[model samples]
Target: MLADELQHKIDFKTKPLGALGHLEYLAHQIGMVQNTVSPELSNPHMVVFAADHGIAASGVSAYPQEVTYQMVMNFLGGGAAINVFCRQHNIAIKIVDAGVNFDFPAGLELMDKKVRKSSRNILEEPAMTSEEYRQALENGKSVVSEIAKTGCNIMGFGEMGIGNTSASSLMMSRLFDLPIVSCIGRGTGLNDTQLLHKIRILSEAIEKYPHIETADEIAETFGGLEIVQMMGAMKEAYDQNMLIMVDGFIASIAVAAVWKKDPQILNNCIFCHVSDENAHQTLLELLGQKALLNLNLRLGEGTGCALAYPLIQSAVNFLNEMSSFEDAHVSNKE
Candidate 1:
C-alpha cells in the first residue's frame, strides 16, 4: 500500500527513527494527500474573505463594523499583516469581499463575490436568508475553482469580519454540544465588562433559536457571510484534492461545519495555529486536530497560514529531497 511505502521511505531517512518528530508525520500526511512519495507544493495562495456581521452592532467586538471594509481596503493596498507575510513567503494573495457592507469602487482588484451587504443581526433573526446562504456557499466554491485552474494545489483560508467570533462561538456550541459561554471569547480584545456583555448577548441569541439543531441550520442561523462562504471554499478545496490550511477561530468554525457534513475532508486539512481566542483550542480538540503553531495569534487574516507555510514546504522538501540512509552510507540502527 502507498501508506506503508511512504512510511518505509520515511523511516529510512538518515536520522534516528522519529527524530524529526511532527515533520515526519507532516511529510507522510502530504504524501498521502497528494498520493505520491515525492510531493510538491505549487502555486500556493492565501484567500482572505471579508464580510460584516450585524451582531457587531450589539458590541460583541471591540472594533466597529466599518472596520471590515476598511481592513479590506488595507488588504488591497498591501498594508495588512497577511500581505506582508504572503509577500515575504512568495505566496499569491487574493482579497475577497464576501459580504462587507461598503460598496467598493470598480477596479479595486478584488474577487467581488459579495453575497449581501451584511448578514442579518443574529440577535434578532437568522444571520442570512436561505437564498443568501446558498449564494455565499456558491461564491466560495466558485472562487476556489478559479484558483485551482491556476494549478494551485495548496491554499489557506482567512476571514475578516466584525463580530464574527460571536458567530463562530455559537456555531461551535451548537455543533459540539457545548455551552455558549464556554465557546465565547474576547474577540478583538474585549475587556472584562465587554466580554461579559458579549457572553450575555450570545446566550440570549442562542435562546432565541432553540430549534437550530443541524450544522446547516446553526450556520445559516448564526454564521457571518465570510464564515458560510469559507465552508463552501473548504468543501470545494477538498474536492479538488488540494491541501487546505485553516486559520484561526472564525475559519475553524467554518471548517467544523464542513467537517460535520463530511468527515473525509479532515484528511486534506491542516489546522494552522491555535488562536488566543478562548475556545479555539477546545474547537481543535473537538475536531480531533492539532495546529502547526501556537504563537498566541489573535489576528484573523490568514497570518497563521502564511507564517506556517515554510514549515509545510519543509515537510514536502525533506520527503522528496533529503538523503536516505542507503544514499548517505549511514548504518541503520539494528
Candidate 2:
C-alpha cells in the first residue's frame, strides 16, 4: 500500500513527469486505497438527503419552507441540476428523504426515516432531542452501510433542507470557536439586515444550548435533520474506505462535523468546492481543505460534487491508461 511502484509507474508516463499535478497525486491515493498499482474506480454514487428545519421560522434563510418539498418534487421529476449532472457522469443518484416535514407520495424511492415532524425551534431550546439526534446519526450511518454493501467505493453526499444553513452556521461557530458573525453567511441570498438577523437568531440558539462535546450533543444542540444524518453517513463511508466527495456549504458543514468527531476521516474525504457562501471558506480553512473548485455556487443540491466527478475520474484514468515512456518507446525528459 506504499504506492512506491505505483508512483514510479506514474512518473514514467509518456507526458512530462508530474505534469498532471494533483491529478497524479489523486490517482496515486486511489491506487493505494485499492492496494493496486493501477486502480479501477467505479460505481460512483451521489446520495442527496432531504429534510426540513423548523429553525426556518426564525427567518435565517431567504427561501421559504415550501421550497424544500418543491425541490424534492423537482428532483424526483428529473428537473433538478443534480438529476441532469448525474446523468452526464453516469453516476447513480439516490435521494433520501431523511426527515422531511411533508407528505411524500407512496412507493416513490423516497426514504422515510422521519426523525421528527421537524427539528425543534432553536430559539427556545435544542434543535433535536438527544435520542432523535442519535437515531438520525444511526440512520445516516446505516444508509451508507447499505450503499457500501452494494459495492460503491466512492460516494458523494449532498443535502436538501430549508434553513439548514442556519443550523450549519451555529454548528460551525461552536465547533471551530469562531464568532457567530464569521460562521454565518447570507444563506440563499439574504440582505445585510436579514443576514444580521440570521446571525442573531443562530447566536441565540447556540447560547441556549449548553456546553457539550460528543457528536450527538453537538448535533442535537444545533444540527438539522439531514445534516446530522449526513455526518453519520460520512463516518460510515470513511470506515469502509469509500471516497467521500463532499458537496459545498451545508454538505461541507456535515463533513466538518464528522471531522470534529474524528479528524482521521479527512484522509478518505475530498472537499469538492468553495461555495458562494462566505462561511464556507472559513469552514474549509478550519478543516484545512482546499476545495477543487471555486465557482461561487451556493446551491445545496450536490451540483458541485457532481461537477467534480469528471476530474476525479480522469485522475484514475490516467493512472490506469496512460503509457510509460519505456512501453511507448518515447524519448524521456532531459
Task: For residues 79-130, write the lDDT of model 1, one tens digit per residue.
Answer: 9999999999999999999999999999888999998899999888899999
lDDT of each: 0.94, 0.85
Which 10-residue span in candidate 2 carries the lowest summed lDDT? 209-218
| Deviation from native of the Cα of residue 294 in model 2, angstroms | 1.5
**Candidate number with greatest lDDT:** 1
Task: Give the C-alpha miss distance for residue 245 in model 2, angstroms.
Answer: 0.8
- Which pairs of residues clash in candidate 2, taking residues 3 or more apart in a chain or in different chains? none
Off by over 4 Å in 2: none
Q: Point out the worst 10-residue segment of candidate 1 by lDDT.
A: 209-218
Instruction: Give the number of colliding residue pairs in candidate 2.
Output: 0
